[model samples]
Target: MSSSSTFPRARKPKLGYDTDQVEEFLRVARRAFDGTPAPGDPEVSAEKIRLTAFGMQKGGYSTAHVDAALERLEDAFAARERQIAARLHGDEAWLREARTTAQVVSNRLARADGERFERVNPLVLGYSVKEVDRFAERLSRYFSDGWPIGIDDVRTVTFRAQRGGYRESQVDLVLDAVVDVMLAVR
Candidate 1:
């Protein structure tokens, strides 16, 4: 069970999330996570959580703080789901899926850095090409040599936004897939 205490209380001003609403939502989410259904519980899927919106209140929860907490919750749920899938399907099946997914990611990474992802207009901001490429190299190594990397490592990867860099969404989606593969195999 996640304690409400772990969530920072919102301020009194209207700039933050509504304190009561966020707390109540978290409580229900935590219950749902514990396998006890709560009334009006949102689907705890990673995409749903990532796209969740909270009502703002004068002194409500800090947006950044709540967002960070939600990200952690999404990761936990994803990891648990992967664990259940692996247990049900067996290691061989999970490994095969992981390898296949890794190969897809590796193939994308094999392209030249400038061509690896869809590019935005030169004036638009996107992920740094060099940074993403370097990380892609590490991912390639992981797939080829069975490197000691973890799902969290992939989940936490960040790149600087730059002009004419790879599409941020593309890289993020691939990283999400990588995390899924790592979790499934673990």
Candidate 2:
């Protein structure tokens, strides 16, 4: 498929995600989403879409557009997964699993700022403790106080890097779990 029909190009002198890579991935994702994935295809899942990264090239597909599309695709996959689970396990069981995940996430966020997630080495840079803590507070409130926090908010959040700050992978795992729970209940 032509990248132009799939997404707009970045303006000249600007760099965006590699067009060929994104186009091919999207085609594979479409097949996966339709449950017609071919043999030897890389397993495509909602988590895979969330973790996907593309190389950059000048005048390539717009990063923002590609990212937004990916988010929507991930949501579609998540919802499909949720439906399948519910059909297989019953709605109550599915809801129970979601509740358990939410509890675990809330407990993790319950820690004091700068202590919630593991920190990196003194010389290694990680997510800013202050920024992550602030976001954690919001997440905590969303769970404990029923504050409205969209999945997109967590999906798109960015934290500044700091020396000896919270570990990125750990934070990301929690965020992904939160998204899973949110998608489950939706």
Candidate 3:
């Protein structure tokens, strides 16, 4: 009976928001930024607000606004991905664990065929659990500034970065170490 395609448009023009504003934008749907939820729980309310806000009003958005938001979101996601990836790529402890694990894996492959080492450099042989701990300890010594977020923030950040291939166990361990150090300083 109605000719309208959509109902209840966005009250605020998020599309018109500048870059800095978008970066800090939280969907205006949540009542408050309260404490953390339990483990494995989603930030459902916040996520739903964002999705519904854009999706529900998709038809109303100018292509430029949608494009801009999409671009900003993409960049943020990419940066977070790189931040997590860099953990394994250069983390002394992670590299050591991976190297040690790889060495064992590689040796097995090498044993299967004598020329395996020629095709793949086995790094596990070079790693020791002790070595990784020492490096992790050293890493723990470095400090970052700011009103560091709570344990919940650690959980949130970890969960956010997992889509880029970050393992949950690894994130927990690294964050555990980082949080311990930060807490100790306080």
Q: TM-score ranking from best to worst?
A: 2, 1, 3
Residue pairs with clashing backbones, model 3: 99-124, 100-124, 103-124
**Top candidate when judged by TM-score against the true structure:** 2
Number of clashes found in candidate 3: 3
Model 3 has an lDDT value of 0.35
Tell me the tens digit of each residue's lDDT in model 2 across 1-186.
Answer: 556778999988999999999998998999998889988779898889999999999989999999999999998998888888889999999999999999999999999988999999989999999999999999999999989999899998999989999999999999999998888888
The TM-scores, one per candidate, come to: 0.72, 0.95, 0.22
Of 1 and 2, the candidate ahead on lDDT is 2
Candidate 1 lDDT over residue span 3-58, tens digit each: 34545656554387766777776877778788997667766665556556788766
Candidate 1 ranges with C-alpha deviation above 4 Å: 1-4, 8-25, 46-72, 86-91
Best by lDDT: 2
Query: For each candidate, C-alpha RMSD in Å?
Result: 3.9, 1.2, 16.6
lDDT of model 3, residue 84: 57
Runs off by more than 4 Å, candidate 3: 1-59, 91-186
